[model samples]
Target: MDCVVTGGNVKVLAKAVHSLSRIGDELYVEPQEDGLALRSVNSSRSAYACFLFAPLFFSRYTIPSGHAFRCKMAIKSVQAVFRSLASLEKTVEKCHIELEEQKNRLTFTLHCKHGLLKTHNLSFQDSESLQAVFDKDSCANVFRLLVDAVVHFPPSQEEVTVSVSEERMWVRNHVEEEDQSKAMLTELCLASDEFDHFSVQTHNNVTFCLKELRGLLMFAESTGLPISMYFDEPGSPLVLSVTDSVLEGNFVLATLSDDTIFRSLVRTQTPPPPPDDFMNDDIDSYLIAMDTSIAPGPSASGPPTPPLADSLCQKQPAAANHRTRSYIDEKEDDLASSERPPNKKFCSLFFGSVLPPSSQMNTQLVTSQEVLASDSEDD
Candidate 1:
């Protein structure tokens, strides 16, 4: 099998290679008629990431008809060959990839500018492609938001907690932020209006890592496109996906349970917040008390979103609904000088929900009272 990648796609392939390196030392490459599939899974099994580059993404794609080609190589080997990814467009004329089945080496040749040339032989073994298979239809919540909204990640942060209610969706640092060294939790909110389609079965909240999420964000930072997020509930897999005209990518991350996070935090020196305040901002607390109704619960009655493409990529709108204005309403606060128990779990949340009109809530309550009074009199 032989394939050629030129132009900007070389850069795209480079980003894919870098992302797979995050998961494990081993990298799996599969070439189909449509495009190439790259996959990696961490040793801990906490995360799995995949990248798909459509045939159109390549300048020239070739393989035997009715057959797929795949191989496994150390991520270090792949990186060694594509060392000039950052300058591939300017430094490289074309990249020709071929499989030497007899030698068990994947030979990579870099055709460079000014008549320069380079070749690298990366050792590999015949293997099957790795695929992430999950039922998107089982996921209860799905929405789309800007990449900029999320990539504001702080250093030294581990897991990220996503808190969703009827009104809004937001994510904050999953690790306890009480330590002075670590900055206050970074929260990113997505308004109801900001989402092209936001739906949830219950007020679903889950905690996942930012590693894979950051990888995809970095890949398409130049595209400035809206990405899609879909998940079911706590202790389930979360899928973050992005789509372009000819390419798509999916990052499957396993979500940690609130209890699991709490237990882990218990083993740490950081103090845990009050239960009600756990994982949620003070505002999310106020909203939870009110009789907010008739929305966010529509997941039960709504139609199931089409499953992800070939069970990996989730197709989304090309453009999001534009808004003329924006708001930066809340700011995270520093922890108090006094620390609480080290064993209690810690969680934080952000909400950008649009509150219903006060009059509407009052009217609904009044109607319920009137119906109860009539029933009492009849009895």
Candidate 2:
């Protein structure tokens, strides 16, 4: 595959590439018979950008139809080739790209106006294309604005809120730190015609990264086309695009959620532990000792429920062992009472974690007969 970009179109391409470079250091080039696509995503995967240039956008586009291939190169390598886009616009006659399959490299050939030619061989990596499909038709909010109006919008340093309602449409960007909620902001009360169309099926005021939106705005400002915005909800991404006769740029940014909402998600995912300092090893040992309890019959109080320390509440370590011993002794006394009904018998005080509520204890533990024999002389 081979292609060439020349004339003022190179500046537009440069602007798009520059904008995408801010999103990521790596760039993926996809060539097709129709056009070329440059795509990038930021480190945090929060921002994504794609620029597509139609065949007509370039002077000499040559891609064999049905041929398919993709390559990855550092954005810096490509940016270095057009670092002086302003001067290249005047001094460079054209730019050509050809794949050197044998060497596994992309050869960038610059044709200068004064018989000067510079060649750069940029390395590449095997990569796949990134495709994200969203339901634009079902979007809750959509709008279009004159591209140049971007310069007047927030520079992205502050919070940007896009609010739409039946009565009015306005974009407000705070120019201060987040803590300064009332700080001065740039507000544009746009009319219906101010944009190609300002329509919101459902009233919405979505807040998102102004920086990302501003980046796309600056990239497309030179195109002098309209900006198309699509968004569904607060947590979903906000989509922005600019298209002209030559190239189309699409950028998407993940929306920032309120701290409270974010915290709620975290809490839901990981439930807070109970205040009680329960240990599996302690419960295991207690379960192992239960079968050895000496019992006459049922207690008037019935089976003892675990004390707070053994229940859901946490106990201070210094008092833990002492408190647990006392609770156990009381349970043992109740089990040894003669008033206990012959049919009513329990081995130990237990909570949900210690053991199941079966009438008989686990046979694995030493039975009450052995326990009574060992302590007969002392009793």
Candidate 3:
């Protein structure tokens, strides 16, 4: 496969390469009958980007007839070819890309003024085309905005939240609960009328990484195109695209769902243990022992429930052996009682009335047994 880019299109290709570098370290090159496809997926596989440059976009384009293949090269190698976009635009007159299957290399030839010709032969491996599956036309919400609106966001910010309502929209940096005391919060609010085009079939919020968005915006701004976003619910992929007659770009980004945010919040809200003191590991066992002495037995209609103490008491970890010895001794006294009925003693020993009622104790026992069963399954 071979193609030639000349004049202003050289800079356009450079900007496209620069934009793709931000999403992934590897660049996928595919030559098709229609155009050349350049794609990348981030390390986490959560973000994807693709740029298609039609034949019209390039001055000269050629591909072997009935011959199709895909290859991938390090993004850094491609970036090095287009490094220093300022100087590239000034000196480079034309750029040529060709694949040498025999040598297993992708060649880049630069034609510059003053009769200078420079070439780079970079090694690449055969690969399958990287395609992201996302339905853009079926999206319920669509927002069109100028790149300048988000250019002011801090470069250090990792992720941002987009919240839209009937009246307004908010774009803000996402800060963890632990960092709220010290982290800076930056937010941009725009009324519905302020957007270039706003069509909201459903009010929704989504959180996604800002780095790739910023990179794509840079390319859009250079091409004088507005960024269009299409999305449905939070967990669904967010599709951002820039399309024109000759060039088209698409970005699919994973968004954090409301359920994910809620789970994170729940984790952060859990109280921490005391820093100076270590809680006793056998405290629950002791509490159950104390409660069992006074707790009533199961209903007369039902058979006596087996005690959880048999397993709990049999295998005492070494760490808790010292602390639990006294409690075990007390339980032994109840078990040794000869005058009490066997059922009465069994009920008194396992389901004491110290803290919770018999019904509550049964529930606690069932929950503990479930946890143990789960643990065993994991093992």
Candidate 4:
């Protein structure tokens, strides 16, 4: 497999890689007769992303006659190669990708200006094509949102709830069951006019990860396109997509089944029941007097324990907590910190282990020789 990407399209490809890296650890590269498919699924498999770059998107495209070439490699292996998008766009003239069957390696050769070339060879393993099966046509709710819609969300926010109605749409940070009291609820409401196209057959709420949505939005924002959302019930998967004439991206994310988020929102909206008229007006004074009168002596079982608040306020010595590391060590620590714990459940079951032959997909013939790149790489 071999393909070449030239001009500003190189940045677009780099942006695609960076966006996919945000969703999963591994990148699946499939060089089909029609186009090149790049896909990724997160650690928990709760989120899956696919980007198909048509032959027209590349300067030249090529593939072997009847052989099927598909492989999976660590996303970081490829992401690092495009880490510097600015330099790639400014200095690189053409990006050539090829598969070396003899060495079983995928090479990314950057043909930079002044006859300079930077090549990256990544190892990969043969794998089946990763795909999820979902019918967007069945989705009762469909809406288009601008990429800037996420600006209202806090950077550290994880999940978000999307509530849609006939008249309006609401996007808010998800409130978990455990942290409702301490969690800050940030919500953004959009009228029908705000969306490019808003249609809601079902007035429902769906909750999904904000991180994955933001990742996809980054790509959409780069392409100067709006994101379209298709979803059904709460537990069902939510599909977000961005498409152009030559390239398309689809992200399938798992939605929370429970109504905890909705309940939290309701609780926040309604005021407490008038402080309960049953409580005597003197209750506050009584509690204050009891606090001063509590002078219990140590019992035979054990000495009196500290109050809960006092115990929680205690802190360890600063010297014991102080620490330092070298730059390399710090980088390793950062990478390790980013690792997520695996979830027992995933949306892959919805798509199954292998793609169904009847799954909805689009394919187009290559118009350029540099368009088709048969390659997969790993660290």
The C-alpha TM-scores of every prediction are 0.64, 0.64, 0.68, 0.70
Task: Name the best candidate (by lDDT).
Answer: 4
In model 3, where do residues sit more than 4 Å from their true spots? 260-379
Q: After superposition, how far is residue 85 of candidate 1 from its true place, in Å?
A: 3.2
lDDT of 1: 0.55
Candidate 4 lDDT at 131 equals 76
Q: Which stretches of candidate 1 lie over 4 Å from their true place?
A: 65-68, 176-183, 260-379
lDDT for residue 274 in candidate 1, whole number 0-100: 38
The TM-score ranking, best first, is: 4, 3, 1, 2
Instruction: Summarize candidate 3's per-residue lDDT along 1-379 as a digit string, tens digits.
Output: 7889998788889999999999989999998877999988776456789999998888888886876788888999999998888888889999999988889998999998887998999999887556665667878888887436566677887777676777677787766544656877676888878778888887676667788898899899888888899876554568889988988999887665321111000111012223432222343554456346323432332333434322221111122222322111112123223111112110001111212232222211111221111111011
**Per-residue alpha-carbon lDDT of candidate 1 for residues 192-295, written as tens digits (9 for 90 to 100):** 77787787676666767676677777776744556788886554567777788877777777664322111111111112233453232332332232212212
Estimate every model's Cα lDDT from 0 to 1: 0.55, 0.56, 0.64, 0.64
Reference-based TM-score, model 2: 0.64
The superposed Cα distance between candidate 1 and the true structure at residue 187, in angstroms, equals 3.0
In model 2, what lDDT does residue 312 have? 17
**Candidate 3 displacement at residue 128 in angstroms:** 1.3
Q: Which candidate do you rate higher for TM-score, 1 or 4?
A: 4
- Which parts of model 2 have CA positions greater than 4 angstroms off? 64-67, 146-158, 174-178, 181-186, 258-379
Model 4 per-residue lDDT tens digits across residues 1-379:
8999998888888888999988988999998777889999776456789999999998898976678888898899999888787687789899999987678889999988899988999998887878765666668998887537788888888777788778788777776544656877777888999888899997676778888888888888777877999997554578999888888899988775421111000101111123543222443353344334333322221322323101000011122321221111112122123221111111221333352343221111111211111111122
